[model samples]
Target: MMTTVVWLRRDLRLIDNPALYHAARRGPVIPLYILDEQEDMGGASCWWLHHSLRALQGQFQSFDCPLILRRGDALSILQELIRDSGADALYWNRLYEPRTIQRDREVKTTLQAEGLEVKTFNSSLLNEPWEVQTGQGGPYKVFTPYWRQAGGQITAKQTLPVRDLGSQDRETASDDLRDWALLPAKPDWSGGLAWRWTPGEKGALDRFDRFLEQRLQLYADKRDFPAVGAISGLSPHLHFGEISVRDIWNRLGHFEDVAGVETSVAKFRSELGWREFSSHLLYHFPEIPEKPFRSQFSVFPWQEDEALLTRWQQGRTGYPFVDAGMRELWQTGFMHNRVRMVVASFLTKNLLIPWQKGAEWFRDTLVDADLASNSASWQWVAGCGADAAPYFRIFNPVTQGQKFDPQGKYIRKWVPELRDLDGDEIHTPWKVAKERTGNYPDPVVDLSVSRERALAAYKSIK
Candidate 1:
């Protein structure tokens, strides 16, 4: 029987995985995962990776195939693996990160040159970034048009059911995953993460099923409330490709006649669209991660206050909602979507901290730290990206907390210091009597003054 090698990356699942599925069609397959160091992979993501890979290894074992783990240059590993296993063909799902795209292209060229049939399939996105375009034959800079055009071209359809990669006799050695040092060892910071998520294909499906059955109906109404927790919590799963967009899309169902269900489903689909738009933005404008998409913001003044930044990072920013969000991110490796925007606004607008710095912090801390989404989102909140939020629409932390976490459940859960404050005092502890206030820090910056300062700064750039 022919031997084929399947390279795994973000696409980690057995079900709905195009690469492993197609490879199984031809003959016996070897599954391999390479820890590519060149990518901007961060610690929490690395922590997630270790567990997810461990889960995936179990998945492959159930199929009677072993997953080979390697750490180093992917091309070098692939070449060595091919020679070692006598594998004549290789398959993998595609990655859209700019550097990854470049690396994969070069690897594909070399593999084809060596007479090894290399096939790559799209398993991550609803539509490949390149497939969608505007009327001007250029990439879309605006989200609505991009979504409309792209949405029309793609359908929620999954391919044939999985046929496992049957056992192969060839023995291939793989590096021990523990030796890679991907997880935190001394002073382990991942205990909270362990509590929050299960790491592989099974986990992704479990989370999706839980959301679809219980939460999808009320998602539209409840998602904005930080206390209610209507989120699918699937970002890291989507980023790692433990589940495919199409699979989730199809599972949400066509629900055409159902009123409330349709609204919630549509909202969720739009979120998926935003994710697609982020990838599309990254594809068309490669510099989005490094530079402002709107060039005028290059000269915009940003604060260089390390002390304040430390406060922000440590979730002592003196604003309950922002602090709660930051603390939640630090402890759980995730944050609520609405609160994320509030924190981003607080950093970039109110404090005048650079968006890049906040983005980097999120990258290191968040399990769902996707470069495309993180970078685009930071820019979006900073009002310096394509179709970005208006600069003057600064979020007042006090009002935001009062509005979303009206009962203070979310704030109390994450920021424990302010737990006893009752009513609106939880949102603005400084407003209450000094004796009633515990040790919660004072407001970092006066809201009105900061708003004026931010607006004036924006005007200078304009």
Candidate 2:
């Protein structure tokens, strides 16, 4: 009689999933996913979700619990399911996105009013956004203190090995995956995406293992280099909650054989801390997605050029490094973290476009696009966010490309038009012979002139 409904969201993995674990304790469980328009999973993300859900469905099937997929209002569907199944309890892991928070709170209130046993737990963040705060009882805006506080307070709990939940029968109809239209149609642009990523719990674990075995040792030193291939590339995994940060944290400490285990662990944890910081920032300042955190930036002159934005999106900005990053993003639904900053800087600074515009584009393209992370990062690059890099430190694209993708291998891979150009010539193809440059476009704007323009704009605002 104690059937429980487990509402699944970003936390797709079954292991160490507090919601799934607790729900499994209460007799038979009805696992569910309800997709709605509120969370606009863009083209690339949708493709990943389709595959990830398929993988997740298989996992649930092995446990004899079908992950019922429904496309509509979550509240209405859950209520109907509850009525039909007579489920007495409901549980879910927390989501911190502002709109999602409001939606969940309303859902919880409505469900609790209906006399259901409702409970929510932290399965997403190592430290829940509210849990980590300042001495004055406020959220920490700066990262270092927040990181120190969070790291000191956080500990990984043991994962739930298995749950002995039995099968549940429900007459409620579920939507077919294909009907959801969570994939591209007409042309299927996800071909490159398919070749690059594997998006599920198993995939997350495998990627994490690879990162640990190969890249973790040099992650601190080489992570900023686009060509280094030292990063974990686990953003999409973390975004979808295929693996928990705590799981990642625990595994990060398993580098005893490496010489600089402590150093590497610290560096990697700092990166995770930055993720936590983004979540924390979003929780406190919900306006990050739309408004600049720094108030003065509200009046900053921004170019509203769709044509320029199109060029930027299509990797024809003619700045080889920026182009490579944009192309990589377009092709694989990911860009190296360093190149992300460089391209973002190029957009919000050099081009003087609104950060929100770039943020929107990323939201539509990135498989790993979490609202908080995307907004926070774009604003940081634009110097309009909390604890952002100073505006004066504009990234020189050619120098950045030369420094990071020094041998231009990363550039060559993504921007093949300049692939034949030797060394640094790959970073500035416009400077190369027209025949050698092939069809690569000229730089959209003079780098030095644009830098000065951006600086002047910043100075005027300041």
Candidate 3:
């Protein structure tokens, strides 16, 4: 019987995993996970990865298959595994990140030359990044047109998890999970993350099921409110590929016939489409992660103030809404989407800081820190990306807080310093008595002055 080694990366789960499914059918399957330095993650992401691997390791135990853990160069590791395990075939899912794409290509070529059967499949995206193209057969730069084309091609196509894995009892040498040190040690700042998240395949499925049953109908109307529990909260799971997008897409169809759910379902699906669009943008424009998509903005004036950036990151920007979002991210490793926009806008425009700085901070702090989404979103807010928001469209943090978080429930929960303030004052505690506001600092920058500065900077480039 043929022996196939299944290399796992972002696709951590077994359900609807194409590479694992196909490899299981052929013969005995060996599951492998390698921690290549090229794909390093932040503190929060590492914490989640540790638990995710532990959960997956337990699942594979049922089939008596050890999830081989190794760290170092992926090519050398794979070659060593092939030679040692006597495995004749290798199977894995595709990752679209620029560095991973190059690494996978090298691994595939070298293994194929050595006469080992190497195969890869897409297990994350509903559509491959290149599959959806414009009328001229080029990549899409705008989202609405892109989704209009891409959304049409999606179907309720589903793949099942491997149900029949032939036993492989060989005790191959494997690195201990503790050696990876993916979890924090000295400081151990992941207490809040533990309270907020359950990072595994079962957790992802449970969250989705809850959304479908109770919150799907309210998603469109209530998703903007930071305090509301209307979101699917599947982003971190999706980033780690704990659940398949195809499965989520197919499951949403089950509620299509339910009355008054059309708008909510469509809204929720489009958010997924945005996730696809981010991948599409990154694949086509690999330089976007490091540079501006709109070349004219390359020379745009941006201040380099470490103190200001630190204030923003610490949620001490003095704008209650922006501070609330930042604090929430620090505490939970996630932020509400609407508040993300407002905070991003404030950093890029109001604070005159570079968007790249904001992106880097988010990458380090967010559990769902995806390169594509982080890069694309920062650029969009900075007015330097494909189909970006206009430069003059500055988001007033005070008004944004008042509008989205009307009762200040979201703000109070995250920014407790101002929790005692009255209804209207919660969004702008600087307006109330200084003693009552406690240590909540005053506005870091005069919004009026900074707005003009940002506009002048844009004018210089234009």
User: Cα lDDT of all candidates, in order?
Assistant: 0.90, 0.89, 0.92
Q: Any idea what lDDT model 3 has? A: 0.92
lDDT of 1 at 157: 74
lDDT of 1 by residue, 378-397 (tens): 99999999889999899888
Please report how far candidate 3 places residue 318 from its true position, in Å: 0.7
- Which ten contiguous residues of candidate 2 have the minimum total lDDT? 253-262
Q: Give lDDT: candidate 2, residue 142.
A: 85
In candidate 3, what are the lDDT values of residues 5-73, reduced to their tens digit?
Answer: 999999999899999999999999989999987675899999999999999999888778879999999
If both were scored by lDDT, which would come out higher, candidate 1 or candidate 2?
A: 1
Stretches off by above 4 angstroms in model 3 are: none
RMSD of each: 1.1, 1.2, 0.9
Cα lDDT tens digits, model 2, 270-381, are 8888999999999999999999999999999898999889999999998899999999999899999999999999998899989999999999999999998999999888
Full candidate order by lDDT, most accurate first = 3, 1, 2
Model 1 vs. true fold: TM: 0.98
Clashes of 3: 0
